[model samples]
Target: MPDYKHFPLADTAEGLTEAEIIDWKVKPGDEVTVNQIVVEVETAKAAVELPIPWAGVVTELLVEPGQTVEVGTPILTVDVDPQGAAAVNGSGSAASAVSAETTETAEAAEADADEMKPLVGYGSKTTVAKRRARKSQATPAAPAPEPVQAVTVVAPRPASEQAAPAGYVPLAKPPVRKLAKELGIDLRTVAGSAEGGVITREDVRRAADGTAETASAAPQPVTAEYDPATRERRVPIRGVRKATANAMVGSAFTAPHVTEFLTIDVTPMMELRQKLKGAPQFSGVKLTPLVIAAKAVCLAARRTPDVNAVWDESSGEIVYKDYVHLGIAAATPRGLVVPKVRDADRKSLAELAGDIGELTAVARDGKTPPEAMLNGTFTITNVGVFGVDTGTPIINPGESAILALGAIRDMPWVVDGELAVRKVMQLSLSFDHRVIDGQQGSQFLADVGELLADPAVAITY
Candidate 1:
């Protein structure tokens, strides 16, 4: 018998450095064909199904669900046989034999095996990273076709006879799938109302909304493995989350930070905002203080370029950026993420507002691409939305400074030697102490303040 070789993880769709394994469609020794959806991966962008690249027996699952693996991490192994015998004899009883003696191991080891079986080091149990590439014979076989079943419904049929009428399609719609997920309903057991016994979206919705019970009958729970709880449940950090955790730890420990704060009267900016609300170009756009604040930061960055520079510790150099890739801190379903807007300084006020609106919408929907979150030159976090008045914000790694804009509210101000009501806001700027001196930080904050205080000055610059 010829000894086989190991296959390292390949770059799945672009150069996405990492992905979390969401679910495995195949296990060790399962025979799979080409283009068959073998695994589900959650990249930073969306949940995607990974089709098998080659036809063969699934030798092993390299990565476990929940682990955030780098782009080139070996996700699984396949025993490809250009000769064809391996697909038939090699997978049949041999697979069943392996399954009979299932190995129970430590969770970490199990996770390693599930994600990617690590290359074992000499005289040690620890797994070691290896080089990445693809095998010439790694192309998988064709997928099996769906079997057709026939159904006959008549008066007083057996329950199982009523169960799967020959060729009965699962009665459910996409929205019903979404609702079923939320309400813990099983659609497979629910009978359909559409032609040819196909399930309609309304059928699933009715069952999920508990309104179907008022009509004909409620669906009995399908004992099929499609348990809503089993479909998805939280797994504490193994896949993408673990990978993100490691990267964050690495960035945090390597970067040093410093922060400063300033209070300013933003009555003028507010007035300008009200005026923009009536503008033809800015019509239908959601113009908020953050939009103006973004503009102020961009304008201020033009005068003070150091605030937008990225510190490259590897090269022992400070990089002064010519363009602003403004990062907006957004809270997402997965975690806290900062997605950047490219060339933010060049965008018009209305364009900036639109881009901000779209990017925020994408982030909230958990559909933001990984590339959108990369290469940020500066970051602004709006704590005001959460009703936070002031906070010392931690600088986003690589970028020299992070600006925290607090709630703009009414406060007493001195005007012409008399107290007057005014709209005021607290701004906190945190920077890398090694890069930004206290004077530079203070001046930057003041520049931002001046723009917000008198919006007209922005035109002069």
Candidate 2:
């Protein structure tokens, strides 16, 4: 007879009610040690790995990959002692007798293990059948979702899923990566035929059948061939994309938005950027216009603290933050993610540039930790990379303001009372009208533009 214990899903972060099981590291009958990583799950924020609380032989995996379950639901079960195998193998009958006698010890250890870890509001440790019975009685079963379309872009893999020295992160989308994992194919060995070396569903299928293609050929488009009769594709709104949609809707509707625009001659800024590129101190650092803008936002916030503040709606108070936690909006394969650069006001220009570059990289790889996405005071979205002048950017939920940076280009400008081809750019700042007055918003935008127009003006701040 085996003594078993259930492992329930725990809240990995604040206010996260549910998570989708991404993949399992262990299956039935596999031996797992205490605090061993057992499964990976994707919540509203980011992907997280969960550890088993007890050392035991895994008796059953209650959940399957891709299934979304509420927090506190048991996802795994383990037999704490299957005929005292550890006692039998390690220290003979004396240890074996101890193992049998210490069943209560095993239970105590599991409880202590969970208490040591920071899993907020752990789910109930009940049998799976009871959970199903209660859930089914609460509501009528809904119709099944349409199969989600495979994304064309690649997603970064976890370290355990990687191969070789410190692991190689393959460039394949989530669906494609799942397929490769199921087929027992090594993604690193397969040459991607898609644009920018991204692996496709077809590529994975070919690799599975030993007929993959080379990287030299032109990238072929992934056909929407799932249903020829319908001639349509459907993607289920879940995970990051789903969360983004809800946040945007809530922010757009709730916030009293006011956008102000400014056109500036940033020839001096571009000149300064060129000069700094050759400097040893700025070596290997990305000193883009965004970096300069980031610094300007920090400096401008000192004059007007409203932009670096949030609305505490629940408490009916407008909170002003003394420190700046700057967020850079990044568009990733999954969705829009605004990861913060902590204490932006305290960092030098080079340090700010490095932090932004690193944040962008991790975000694009879909590896941004949940902690990175929280507590942002202000945000700067550089829409210039997409080659547009400027648009009204919605303020992030809870934050007071957002700035959109437009493309920098050679435009005809009256420089020093004369017409000249100067490096010009447009700035659009959107702020919550309730928190920021028109005068304050305009002044902050002006300060940012003035600093960019004359890099020397940063010292005056």
Question: How accurate locally is residue 270 in candidate 1, as Cα lDDT from 0 to 100?
Answer: 91
Query: Per-residue lDDT for 344-457 in model 1, tens only?
Result: 999999988999988898888766765677788988999998989888777766688889999988999997799999999999998876777788788888999899899899
Tell me how far the alpha carbon of residue 282 in candidate 2 is from the true structure, in angstroms, after superposition: 2.5
Full-model lDDT for every candidate: 0.64, 0.75
Give each model a TM-score.
Answer: 0.57, 0.69
Candidate 2, residues 1-461: lDDT per residue as tens digits?
A: 24456676777877887777888999888998877889988888877788776787886676667666656655776777655443333223342333333434323323422433347333323432211111112223333221111110112333433443221233555467668767866566677777546688889889889788533222232222456688778666777878888998999999999999999999999999999988887888889999999999999999999898878889999999999999999998878999999999999999999999999999998878778889999999999999999999998997999999999999999977999999999999999998999999999999999999998988887
Lowest lDDT 10-mer window, candidate 2? Answer: 145-154
> Which candidate comes out best when scored by lDDT?
2
- Name the regions of candidate 2 deviating beyond 4 angstroms: 1-5, 29-36, 51-57, 78-117, 120-226
